[model samples]
Target chain A: MDLTDRPDLAYDVFAKACPSRGTLEHVTGRWGALTLGALAEGSLRFNELRRRVEGVSEKMLSQTLHALERDGLVHREAQPTNPPRVDYELTPLGHEVAGRLLTLIHFLEGRMDEVLGARERYDTARGGR
Target chain B: MDLTDRPDLAYDVFAKACPSRGTLEHVTGRWGALTLGALAEGSLRFNELRRRVEGVSEKMLSQTLHALERDGLVHREAQPTNPPRVDYELTPLGHEVAGRLLTLIHFLEGRMDEVLGARERYDTARGGR
Candidate 1:
């Protein structure tokens, strides 16, 4: 079964104490969204992920990857060499979330014109904030 | 057309300069996610939204709703009266994005057990961080 298609489990995101909130934060974080989207295309070396994610600091990149890895949404593999080679890929679960996230990003990107128009109207109505 | 089903729009979220990045940030923010999800069921009053989204401060909730409204993802209707009641609901575009986001949240919440297990394994291997 695809990791993203779990139908038998449930929790209320609205609950203050639900563990799902932390997971949501990790899955939908600013960098987290981009990282998963990029990786959804395929696995990449550390530098490749950093490059694809654009403007992500090395520290932030590693932290994001580490958190995803810890949550089982991402898998990190190390190849022993003169210098260790590390590669990151989505687990089946990661792909599921990434696919949906990519769709949302695409949708938002497509609607930029509308969003910008609304922003202009809002600002105008508010007499410029 | 269902706003969530846009196939003709595209943008590289990987690029740092994409305006969609800003939109994505607003849509997927911590409080933003819960707010959108709550509003998806139906239009809600300010206090109703506050109650459903638990753990959100009044300032943060208002800020999130304003951003969502500005982005054209949500509709805010004010019934001028003694107290001027305001109700929030998803726009077509908002419904599309919120639908996907809610799915992801459901997915993540469903898999909390896996995430916790993974975290335990990760910590064990790291000798406890």
Candidate 2:
């Protein structure tokens, strides 16, 4: 079914066949999470963002950024200059989502200690120690 | 590098090359998200859970539950009964994480309207209209 057909219908992430799943995959992707977190600090050029987020291939970086850009979560600014310069920043909606995303990151950080301890206990219990 | 070696080191989801990325993938898998959301309500038998979560095959459900169980996030209880009956519930740790997971689901639900509107606006802007 076309989600667009139901313009009045609200989008639920939990829906089995919702296209939002693709959006979630894009936003929560390996590079996407890092990109979002990096951009959360402020806007950055494509190269700058690539450098800030370690272990990302140029192709993946460009692709992720494009996906985010297409979704309207990211705004891309291009400057006509020598060698070209571009910047990426969050949209208003992006800012709100990023705020919640940061909340998830913070929540994970707060529980890191406990999760680590549990991992150790788990390893020992499973005879992996 | 072995994350197990650094037992004291906390796991960050954003950290590059971190094993926790694997955990996140498992918990946030296509099936994983659905499984967690389904189990949030209460414990369920394996068959029951599989049925409750639509569009999931037996293989994926088994794999996702196994991963959760291994990570100490889910407690699997097998009852010695005819034809074998099993129940799955969140551990104390699982309860904490699942609470946050539910919060995410709820947050998405509340913002479903704005997201749909954004999607429509995005489609129009992108000439997908």
Error of 1 at A95 (Å): 1.2
Give lDDT tens digits, candidate 2, residues B1-129: 685776546566656776566666655667766677778879998988887776688998898897787776778899899988899987787776677666665555555566666667777877985
lDDT score of residue B46 within candidate 2 = 90
Worst window of 10 by summed lDDT in candidate 1 chain A: A1-10
Q: Candidate 2 clashing pairs? A: none
lDDT, candidate 2, at B98: 70
lDDT of 1 by residue, A1-129 (tens): 563474553467798887788888888998999999999989999999988999999999989999999988999989887688988999988898898888778777777888888888988999998
Show where candidate 2 strays beyond 4 Å: A1-9, A116-129, B1-10, B116-129
Residues A4-103, model 2: lDDT tens digits: 7765355555566765666666666677767887898899998788888877899999999887876667888998989888989998867766776666
CA-based DockQ, model 2:
0.33
- Residue lDDT tens for model 1, B1-129: 564475453455678887778788888989999999998899999999999999999999999999998888889999888878998999998999999888788778777888889989999999998
